[model samples]
Target: MAGRRALKAVLIDLSGTLHIEDTAVPGAQDALNRLRQASVAVKFVTNTTKESKQNLLERLQHLNFNLHEKEIFTSLSAARSLLEQKQLRPLLLVEDSALEDFNGIDTLEPNSVVVGLAPDHFNYQTLNRAFRLILDGAPLIAIHKARYYKQKDGLALGPGPFVTGLEYATDCKATVVGKPEKSFFTQALTDVGCSPSEAVMIGDDARDDVGGAQNAGMLGILVKTGKYREGDENKINPPPHLTCDSFPDAVEHILQNLL
Candidate 1:
């Protein structure tokens, strides 16, 4: 394929693209260093909702990955932006500390509701109350839409299934403020002041990063890392523009075909 010489930015997925389970992928760090040396701007886009933006950055730094807070985009950030844009004040169903510095619209009304990963807090009473709020027409917002996430032990139920239950009980569709949604992608591009054509989305999840970016008019590159297995290509609805063995190879392809 001809190089997209106009490309100016690269959006990478954190888990599969850079590392897996707190361990940096081989050649991932070097690839990022190369991009920085070349002055090619980069952004880390993720669907993880369990950690705050600062926390995520700190973790990455601890892993020896050079990144700044501003270079990261989380689904939580997108959720906050959507709430602000819709002018919806919600009754938060999230972690108390998560909203400490949240500057978005107030989410404290009786009719407002927001759900977070509260495994320890989830119970019959709380869920019942949340359902009532939803029945009352409060807008539902979720940070992630994943059915489950990979863990050292095994797969764990993600926020998606819980969000789905709420949607079914109240018949209200939850507005997902994460990947595969155009709003989040648009927000990231706007934040960097870059066009979709100038950016490439690289990730292991075919549905979220690759398909999402392609849907928004950007190039998508799939990496064979986290959550992706051999022969998973048949499952991709909209095939990626390029597929690489790992993040390092993906970066090399970008340098050759895009830069």
Candidate 2:
């Protein structure tokens, strides 16, 4: 706390911090409004690979969040940027619904293996192709390495295990482009025109949102919502700057204390 800088912008995790699945976190709208009233820059950062950015925006709008596409940064967005820059054609192992984000990309030759949480596409044939591609020198690009995520039913496996399995089989490590990865956080912070020390990251996932932000020199606030499990905060290497009950409470904390 002694070395912490003043909070100027906030990078919020979407799935757990603001909502889980399709439902908005209780009081999330009000908390967001408070941030707007506080006049701090805000960005919504997410590792959710289940839907394309446009679909995600629609879902958020349905949940009553007033966010612009520019303010929303996804791991997929980061992956897309990298892919386009490298001019790598992806052998996509992503959800069909999420394919729209990579819509314009050329995938005819399948130069790289872009893996996300595509449950339906995790069969032997599809994975075998990705595995062979990686073994044949194509890079494995993971959107994120989340072990698991919260769903409406309960906790469910995420893409981390699958990504690692492929890594072990192919003896190739994945280039992660999502949370817990500094690029994702830094890029979002930079887009908001704030240095890492001047911004804060708020989310439910201790490892990804909180730990990742902390590692990147931003203050991290762990919210007890979404995929949060008890003792998660204690497990992080450098613990979150604060832990709160919900997004609104985190908003209150930032306004009253950090600002």
Candidate 3:
């Protein structure tokens, strides 16, 4: 900590660190408020492809989080940017709710396959169609290959396995555009005008959030809530700067120590 840059921003993970499903982590809202009051820039980052940004915003608001749409960034946003950059018509295998994020993209004659966490769209017919397209030279775009996420019921499958299946069968590697990707962290940090060394990432996923940010040159805090399992801090090389029990604890560390 001797030579670290002064903290100027915080990139927070959405689902596990702040909330799980419809329930906000205990005192998370207040914790966020405290951070805001400190005058540091704050941004929300997530790989949730289950719903559109608008829908996700509504859910967060319903849970009493005070945030704006522009302050939130999702993996869907990154995938859309990639789609536009490549100018490829994608066969989006994402949830109907998430399709709203890709509304303007051409999907009629798909030249690419974009996969997310869409249980309803993971059927044999849909996958077969995507498989055929990939076989025909369509690029496979994976929004994020997360293994599992925490829900009210417990851990559930994420889109990683499905994306890997497509990759294995098609013999084509997927272009991932989400967490743990340096580009994703850079995009979020750029928007807030903060350098990675001057920011911190607080999240529950050890690999995607903490390790990812650390890889991008920021400090990371691993919280025990959300999808965190036992000994997750040890799963990654160069463990988190700190591990807290919840969002509030992370915030406390930031406010007391980092500031």
Candidate 4:
């Protein structure tokens, strides 16, 4: 394949791409500052569904990340949009604060359902109830399809399996609202007023970021900082347009090549 072309906008992962364990990676902030100075459009895309949009913005601000809420896109936001478009309220199988910003009605009606990450609230009983609701014709929606997320300690089960189990028991398909889905990428591009070909996605996860971008008709760049390991490049079904050591390096490459 040809090398990834220049981009009018850059979509970046938040956690490992910008900061690790609350610490901003070396040159990460500088790179973002440079992008701003050069007037390069940028968006932060994250799969984290544990926090509300306001809370996420506040947290990132507390971490000294100079970003606006509009430039951030989360799986939770996607899921919320999906439910609202359907005019269906969900039982909300998520954290108490997850539905705080959502506009949908909350009810136990047969048309209502659940969506979100499952950690503390995930138990056999919760799964059973979710299953029952799905069997009753309630739709299941997943924020992101990630099976696990990297933690400081180790890998832990994420929202994917819980959603999968419910799908299995209820025999209902779930609408995934996160990356690798065209809706999420298209929405982000639309927010910036850029075409799919005018944007580039950079992240540590090849499948979620790189592969997703490629599938969305955007350029994809992979960074070997977070979950990506050595020898994983060969495994990418469609190789990324470019690969770098970290977010800073990736930003530098964008500056050098695109600007």
Specify the highest-TM-score model's number.
3
Per-residue accuracy of model 2 over 143-175 as CA lDDT, tens digit each:
999999988989888999999999999888999
lDDT score for candidate 4 against the true structure: 0.78
Please identify which of the two predictions, 3 or 4, would achieve the higher lDDT against the true structure.
3
What C-alpha lDDT do the candidate models reach, one value each? 0.79, 0.91, 0.93, 0.78
CA-only RMSD, every prediction = 2.2, 1.1, 0.9, 2.1
Report the C-alpha lDDT of model 4 over 138-240, residue by residue, as the tens digit: 7888887776766778777878888888888887789888877888898887868878888889888788888888889987888887677787566677788
Model 4 misplaced stretches (Cα beyond 4 Å): 1-6, 108-110
> How well does model 1 score by local distance difference test?
0.79
Give me the runs in candidate 3 sitting further than 4 Å from their true place: none
**Deviation from native of the Cα of residue 234 in model 4, angstroms:** 2.8
Q: Candidate 2: where is the Cα deviation over 4 Å? A: 1-3
- Each model's TM-score, in the order given? 0.90, 0.97, 0.98, 0.92
lDDT of 1 by residue, 1-259 (tens): 3544588788999976788778888988888988777656789999876667887788889889998998998887877776777777866655654564355456555566667665644567887888898897777887767766667676677777888998999888988888878777878887788888778999988878888888887889988888876866556767898888899899888887677
**How many pairs of residues collide in model 3?**
0
Ranking of models by lDDT: 3, 2, 1, 4
Error of 4 at 4 (Å): 7.7
- Between prediction 2 and prediction 3, the one with superior lDDT is 3
